[model samples]
Target: MADRWYPMGVPSFSRLAHEVPEPGMLVAHDRALYRVIVVHEDHPANWAEKDRNRLVQNRRAVEERKRHRARPLPREVFYPSPLDGWDGSEETWPNRPRGVELQPMAGGKRLHAGWPHPGWAYWYPVDEHHPVCASCGEPFPCREVDAAKEAARQMVKVEKLMAVGPSCCWHCGEPITSRQGARTFPGENLLLPGGPSPSFHQRKTGGCLYAAKEYEKKWREANPDLAETADLFGPADA
Candidate 1:
């Protein structure tokens, strides 16, 4: 597929191969002989398990013989969101009404609710100045004042969501939205454990947002009572 080519000066390669620069054409490489352009594979040498095993086996010999080293995986590779803590058994979110249930956004889509760093909305400070419409209290179709108030309310919800003690990205204030969006820890920070280590006890890296979901998956996989939970929480409206 990549073998096709277009000339630099002329639009077509076939015509440019022989055309000379008079008013338009320019003579380039000779067209009499065929030249082969080799394309090598760009996959990393240690991409596969077998390649990794071979590399490990040859490590001592390679080091002793001073052979070139294979490139290592980038230290800054993205990590998935860490799992949520408490299994939905405890109340951690603050300034929330009782029995308020906020479902995680769809497509593993992380909402911009602020993580460790304060966001533009934070400086604005949502309050009564931006009150919900007296006519309608629901989220949308409100004035700028109401929108800012809603953003504040949502930010509160987000804080409550994370107060359960989930590990969050430093840049974004919300839960690590996408594992692919996560960056490497820049330095020692509050989110890490004992310095550079991840907080695994409270959260599982790359796991679901709610611990209840994980529990349900495991329970259903092991037991035959998956159908019985229909009356418990019912289907997610998400």
Candidate 2:
């Protein structure tokens, strides 16, 4: 005789009549594979009980999901501090600004508490009237400091440009004459000595073009700082 199959009772298929097979019969239903220990009458009461248990399981699953779902933290909570492991003592944080205190937070985490905010280690106001920069925690309108920083950056760039040797063909290492056809690198005005572009190949001969290209590739690999600046300026014209 051919093997027969029967589905177990579930809430969706409860209305369908299910026939109970003999004991030790193999049953596969709802992803569950089991052998029947004993045969029982297929009754509506048994299906109703199973349905009640399934409903309870579904309610429990929903509640579990809700419990684990992330919710917005309060403004006071801010975010995890870099000093999360620091002990709640001023001596530990010697650099901790005046009026800031080490405050104990939830989950045994400690944070640097400043006026009007918590959990931010660097944020503090100069006074009640002046707002602070979110990053540096300095007073607003820090133009002087910003200008000084920019000047310093420019000075570094100038120094790097000055470090590059005089205008010459990268391939030949020969000094580029004024009469030669030249290709200008990015920031050539600052980079080349006396403000002249490097001569790669003479337009008449074009002999050094391929070698210049290969040499430039290696040069760019060696000088990453100038390579980034070169990318910003894009390909130079002949």
In TM-score terms, which candidate is top? 2
Whole-model lDDT per candidate? 0.31, 0.41
Q: Per-residue CA lDDT of candidate 1, range 65-109, in tens?
A: 344534323541343111112122112311111111111212242
Give me the displacement of residue 48 in model 1, in angstroms: 50
Query: TM-score of the candidate numbered 1?
Result: 0.15
Residues 1-238 of candidate 2 have per-residue lDDT tens digits of: 1122122111232110122133443333222233334422323233454444544554554455457854533641664332334443333421232222232211243223222122222221112243434666434323444556568877876675455457766445566788876654543432334655444654435456765565467657666787776453344445
Task: Please give the distance, in angstroms, between residue 89's alpha carbon in candidate 2 and its true position after superposition.
Answer: 44
**Model 2 weakest 10-residue run by lDDT:** 1-10
lDDT, residue 210, candidate 2: 66
Model 1 lDDT, residue 79, Cα = 30
Off by over 4 Å in 2: 1-141, 166-194, 198-238
Candidate 2 lDDT at 101 equals: 26
